[model samples]
Target: MAGSAARELSFLTISFDERLVEVGSNKCRDAFRELFDHFAPRLKSFYLKGGSEEAAAEELVQETFVLIWRKAALYDPQKAAASTWIYTIARNLRIDRLRKEKAMIYKEEEFFATKLTTHETQTDVTYQNQMNTQLAQAIAKLPAPQAQVITLAFFEEATHSDIAKRLALPLGTVKSRLRLAFTRLAEMLEGSKQ
Candidate 1:
């Protein structure tokens, strides 16, 4: 409606950066509409100059406005002028769309790729999950001292020396427990396989 358009212009009374901050803090639809009014045409022209179809340019403008709304809080006036920052966002989004289209083209070319490969990948994932479950069960079966050492070494990704420091144990003691734990796990897994 003409009333909506007039309201959009009313927002021009404030600076663009202040409007963006208002979008950030208040999520005001009128402020957003104002921003859309100001930027959408300029963005469309920029896109058209770079060879986008009219519909695609319009879509990009809509998407850019959406980003402005959602990511308003991330805007910092100290970094760059509002126009420069907004232009950068639109440019990045366009590049991303082009890259995604290229990637999808490659994906489409792989449509004839074998179901056998997909099945094998699924089977490999299943096997890995089962092995992880069995290994966790085996670790659980271990005595507390051995389990503690194994957990610190593998689960927590602590080096043996780090484990020694964390647990206030001697390095030799930590190494011995780890050796015993590994031997027990090998035996347990072998029994489960049989």
Candidate 2:
């Protein structure tokens, strides 16, 4: 009985090893399917035992199989059994996933560490409010034609050609109006600062 069990074990190992070699040489889907069917469940169990969540374990299994398919040509029976090589791939993939997760967490912690505080947010809002008020007063003092072009170009984000088409003016007339509007607004805002 002991002799028969040893023979069976040896046969199974050789069979899988041969199948893996066939996959490398021939790109045989049938052999790959058999390997996947045999190892996927066991690999999942291994990952679960290693504290991976169900989803993460499933991902690791998928990544391992993909690598197996891609790197089958690199396998050497003299270096390791097929099972040992496959499990090593899974282990390395798990380590990579953990490193990426750790990096994302570190980035989040760094962003929070340097984030603007409530006081800074309030001061920014106050400064923005003052600028808006001053800009509104300056715009209100602009002549109607210049104000119209400024409103269309800056507020409505219209192109100069579009503003000329809308206002039934020449393109050069539209450009001059925008330039004059900017100059007047700058002078008004500069005087307000004093």
CA-only RMSD, every prediction? 22.7, 29.3
On residues 1-194, what C-alpha lDDT tens digit does candidate 2 reach at each position?
85575556555666666678778889989989989999999888777766688998898889889988988887655444576567557756665666877445543332343353323323232232343345666677789999999877643446899899999999999999999999887776556434
CA error at residue 13 for candidate 2, angstroms: 0.5
- Candidate 1 clashing pairs, residues 3+ apart or interchain: none
Off by over 4 Å in 2: 100-194
**TM-scores for candidates 1 onward, in order:** 0.44, 0.49
Supply the TM-score for candidate 2. 0.49
lDDT of each: 0.68, 0.70
Given candidate 2, what's the lDDT at residue 155? 37
Clashing pairs for model 2 are: none
Taking the tens digit of each residue's C-alpha lDDT, what string does model 1 give over 19-111? 777788899888788778888898888777555889998998889898888878776543334564576677666666768765444442223
